[model samples]
Target: KPFVRRLRGDLLAHGVPRVWLDEAEIDIGDSLIAKIDEGMKLSRYIAVVLSKKSIDAPWVKKELDVAMNREITSGEVVVLPLLYEPCDLPEFLKGKMYADFSKPDEYEAMLAKLLRRLRIT
Candidate 1:
């Protein structure tokens, strides 16, 4: 959660217009599936923060499926994989170039690369 929070903060600080983080956007009585779907649809890019535990999460799988489907339908890249830990990536995301934040020292450089991709600067 800290990693995500930090990423969100940095993205916002760097002038990302909007960031749809589940914890920040979802309310107590909201429908999780609907909110996630809406977020995926509205986002220009979906950043999947990958880790050992997250790779096996059901919600992650569902989210990835939705993002991949959107990419197929829209005929554009919609998913950005952010490697936060050393782990084997999902087959679908294996070919995508990712911003690696696994090394603490590389955070700034990786973030810069990500911002470039997002055209934020």
Candidate 2:
């Protein structure tokens, strides 16, 4: 989750007014599903970090499902895929362009691209 924390920090530093990181947003007694659902609803875009481990996570799948549903219902792009490691992407994400963070040397460039997509700069 270090990557996520760093990403969140960078995003905030780059003028993203609000970022939804579960650890920061959700309290100890909070319901994970409900909080996540609420976060998805409130967010303009959902950034899905794809790594070998996260790809098979059940919670990640569920979150992706929610993000996909939001995209379908709104008829707009809401999911931003961030590839953190080399892994086979889900079928739905195959054709979508992602910000590649796999190569450490390319992080700043990829982050700039992502910010542009986010229309922050």
lDDT of 1 by residue, 31-111 (tens): 998998888878999999999999999999989998899899989989999999999999988889999999999999999
Tens digit of per-residue lDDT, candidate 2, span 17-64: 999999999999999889998998889999999999999999999999
Which ten-residue region of model 2 has the weakest summed lDDT?
A: 33-42
Against the correct fold, how does model 2 do in TM-score? Answer: 0.97
How many residue pairs in model 2 have overlapping backbones?
0
lDDT of each: 0.94, 0.95
**lDDT, residue 30, model 2:** 97
| Candidate 2: segments with Cα more than 4 A from true spot | none
Looking at model 1, which ten-residue stretch has the lowest summed lDDT? 33-42
Displacement of residue 32 (Cα, Å) in model 2 is 1.0
